[model samples]
Target: MNDKKLELECLRLISDGSGIGYINGIATFVTGLLPGETGVVAVYEAKKKWQRARLQSIIKSSPERIIPPCTVFSGCGGCQLQHMTYEETLIWKQRWVEDALSRIGKLKVTVKPTIGMEHPWRYRNKARLHRESTGKLGYFKERSKTLIHFEDCLLISERMNRWIRLTEEFLTKGYPEIHTLTFRENDKGEGLLLLEGVPTKALSEEENPDLFEALSREGLRSVWGSDSEGNLVLIWGEEMFNQTILDMPFDVSPLSFLQVNSKQTDVLYAHVLAEAALTRAETVWDLYSGIGTLTLALAREAKKVTGIEENPYAVEDAIQNAAKNNAIGHVEFLKGKVESRMMKIEEQPDVVVLDPPRAGMHPEVVKRLLELKPQRIIYVSCDPGTLGRDLRLLSQGGYRVESVQPVDMFPWTQHVETVVCLNRKHS
Candidate 1:
């Protein structure tokens, strides 16, 4: 591809943290360029309406831009917006939510300023690293398969960093079979390892004792691996990984999903509970409830709470979690697709809580909600673009947008978590 060089001035940042500049009515996207910055870029790929360019030289810079401290910040896909100040990033996240609501949903509503952490670094409790062919472990380059190793990832705790080093050193010896490593940590810094490839050697106490011994010595409570059939089996240690969220205990399996940021999950769930405002007489439904975290919380106030989930593993965990939390009597866990299980729910719900996946709600789910017509709906969303589209549908179906709160769950990244509350117009 022939490169065309052009001097561009970035007007704003896009959803992916890339700077967008307009030239001759066509948008040009250049990585590593911040808003209010002018840089000469090499336009490599040009389309009829847009172009992708590479930053060459910065002729001007934004006041909020700062030098990122991460060693692999320029190439690694783990974190974005590291070059911008944290305070400014929070402001932009709020604006992003406002933009999505107005431009996509066509709703003119006030969005509260983003809630940020006092100390944002080292807050992540989970990390997934890809293994290269030679057994080296690291994250991939942005939008590329090229693996880039990091000396130290600032997102996770120091304890996890040590575990990664130990595991990498052990695997580099000859374990070409393992291709991915996932680390999950609890609030106490206890770690769990999940290896996602078949091992040439059996990882048992009798066969390879050193690997487990070293990891166990370093505070790893368990090790799990996927079989050839893709089912997770406990290779060693405890069967379940334990985590405490908002004073409630949870048993998480490798296949289950939990929030990556431990501290912000508390903040996010507290906001959800506050917005729910459930009473003893009210009934609530938690759709897409994973491991029953929010469902159990709602059970404390609601007369009865039902959690609908499709993943059988997550449903099993949620059932056990309800028992562990002593809310088994008030909470019910249904194992099936939410869009299908919702049709069978006999009890009328006073409030409905939705924490759907990043792809957002299915159209049928939205239509069902419109039919059910719950008095109050509290939606927890991770993607703003999808949230806006669903909100537009719900608003058209007779729900008024009450409030939208954006939480900085993943700081130094382009992602955010938002909680929205809506009320039926008749109510």
Candidate 2:
């Protein structure tokens, strides 16, 4: 195939973060192009069936196209749909979820309208920045190995932005071994920092005692450092950073999994609880529970809530969260793999809530659910590809997907969070 500068119209935005077009009957997937837009593309990668191209020039732009506000919009992988309006992104996200359920899962169910954020900017509470050997600190370029250096990121909170600058300055001085720096802020207006570097090099606190003190005084609740093995060691501070979710206080560690958007998380959890429709007499099992965000919420209404998680740190945080919230009697946290624990559950739950990672639920867990036959299941998924596959298996295992609600947790990005409710039919 020869490179051609032919006019092509983009078909649709696919899950892999690209727009589809046809050139000489060969499907082309290119970034920075939207549906209904006509652009001239330069073919870069030609495969047997589909080809990847780079946009040369836009002859006709889509109505949804807008001037992105980010300085590194094209290079940074932090966002994908910055070229389109927020409303259009939400619509496209919902459609993608529906397409996965229908085309991939083979389920003919109504996918409810997407729940969007009123104000979508500067909502991210965490930033993981890559540091170059030359002391350039920023995010990695989209679909490439290049690191795009920046003084600040527009997506994270204003406070975290300044903290990022502070870390960049601190590392630029003498810490050439530090490869990546991560910062996270919570609702309490406090933040934490983690420094990760090469395996051979160790984090030396003695070298930068004054810098550590200054960072702690600058509002970092705690500072941690790590090497290639990815284990965190406390460098300074004893502040137990706590964040409130729906009026319950939960302790957040340096590296625990958290929903990046704090405000939208309130909205997302409300939908999950609503779909649960608990009667205050049900026993609920929250699988893959992270810091008891959903477990504590469910504990308020359910008779008993048992949460099983893989992270021991998160499990400890969950226990402290339950005690801190003074709602311990109704909730319990167990540390282990959820798959192995699923088989040992002698007392079946009336409801099961799964907020698994992007990979979705495990096959063994799905198999165990078929055997347990829980009355109801609420699955919150971040990746639609895995979500579709799990829903297909659950549907085959006698569960029916009742409602699908898409939440725009990370606005201006291609990622979307979905909360699905499934009910089992009487056999």
Give the best candidate by TM-score.
1
Per-model C-alpha lDDT, please? 0.90, 0.85
When summed lDDT is taken over every stretch of 10 residues in candidate 1, the lowest stretch is 198-207
Residue ranges of candidate 1 with Cα displaced over 4 Å: 199-201
Tens-digit lDDT track of model 2 for 11-83: 9999755899888799989898999999998888898888888899999989999998888888777789888
Tens-digit lDDT string for candidate 1 (1-427)? 6777789999998888889998788999988899899999998888999999999999998999999999899888678889999999999899899999999999989999999999999998888888987778898787788898987999988889989998888877876778888999998778998888753235676666887788888899988887666688787788878889889999998878888888889999999999999878889999999999989988988899999999888999999999999997889999999999999887788999999999999999999999999999999999999999999999999999999999999999999899999999974
- Please tell me which predicted candidate would have the highest lDDT against the true structure: 1
* Residue runs of model 2 more than 4 Å from their true location after superposition: 1-3, 197-218
How does residue 405 of candidate 2 score in lDDT?
94
For all the candidates, what are their Cα RMSDs to the real structure? 1.4, 2.1
What shift in Å separates residue 45 of candidate 1 from its native position after superposition?
1.2
